[model samples]
Target: MKDRFVANQNAHLEMVLQQMTERLLQATSRLMARQGRPPQCNYEKKQNVWSLATSRRHCVE
Candidate 1:
């Protein structure tokens, strides 16, 4: 049935989104570890959603 098909498709998409989130978390942790300190991160609110970004700070050694 069309309803069942749509439900299955939505479930598949949800699983993919969860997997992507996990990967992003792992990558961010690695970046933080290599930087030796927490990277400067920024947050912005767009509509009902929030966005985050991280970057290394440049400092003279």
Candidate 2:
């Protein structure tokens, strides 16, 4: 009986973990989409400003 209970608990934990992982992936995708692809610029001023704007837009979205 104890072993069975442990197994059940483990299964429940696994399900919770899976759900958490799915949510995390979804959040990551949304973030990436909002941020768009990485900047192509190599200069500091453009890259910094662009990245800041992307982050701000993501927050608004």
Candidate 3:
């Protein structure tokens, strides 16, 4: 019947919309991460010596 066909079409449309929403969320997350600030790299300078630290303890000294 025509009603059944219409219902099927609506179900398909709903599925497509759900998929698009998921993709949009994933893309937004990726874009936000890329545009966000880079991780801090601690560097210390002591008497002509330059040291780079990537961990917490190493950065302390």
- Write candidate 2's Cα lDDT for 1-61 as tens digits: 9998986896687568656755665566566668985434334454466557656855775
Off by over 4 Å in 1: 38-61
User: Which of candidates 1 and 2 reaches a greater lDDT?
Assistant: 2
Write candidate 3's Cα lDDT for 1-61 as tens digits: 9998986896687568656755665566566669894423311122113212223434463
Report the lDDT tens digits of candidate 1 across residue range 1-61. Answer: 9998986896687568656765676677678879896634421122113112211111211
Clashing pairs in 3: none
Ranking by TM-score: 2, 1, 3
User: After TM-score superposition, what is the CA distance of residue 56 in candidate 3 from its true location, in Å?
Assistant: 49
For residue 6, model 1's alpha carbon misses the true position, in angstroms, by 0.6
Q: Whole-model lDDT for model 3 versus the true structure?
A: 0.51
How high is the CA lDDT of each candidate model?
A: 0.52, 0.62, 0.51
Worst 10 residues of 3 by lDDT: 42-51
- Cα error of candidate 2 at position 39, Å: 14
